[model samples]
Target: MTSSSKGSYTRLCIQVNLDKPLINTVKVGRLKQKVMYEGISFLCFYCGRLGHK
Candidate 1:
């Protein structure tokens, strides 16, 4: 497969709605951990940085 296509499959993007109430810190932390455990890269929507859980 081409690099662009491969990159899309490997990366995981999660878009959180800003209109919703803020998620609890503990819950957010757990979510990140869960995503990491799944072996997919997480990208931060706000800062545009990769999340390291």
Candidate 2:
């Protein structure tokens, strides 16, 4: 199997219209997973950031 250099097994990226509000969660099968950003140290604004949650 081959993989793209852009994403990981647990990660995905897509181009979206910036005019829309960001979605917090996405449905993965039956479970909902929160959307996350990378490279930040820590934060928790309803959603969590790395090293904080």
lDDT against the true structure, per candidate, is 0.41, 0.58
Model 1 worst lDDT window (10 residues): 31-40
> Over 4 Å off in model 1, which ranges?
1-13, 25-53
Best by TM-score: 2
Index of the highest-lDDT prediction? 2
TM-scores for all candidates: the values are 0.20, 0.47
Task: Give a tens-digit lDDT track for model 1, residues 1-53.
Answer: 66666332234456655445323233444453222323336644344345542
Superposed Cα deviation of residue 7, candidate 1 (Å): 25
lDDT of 2 by residue, 1-53 (tens): 45655454376667654345446788989978787755545544445333464
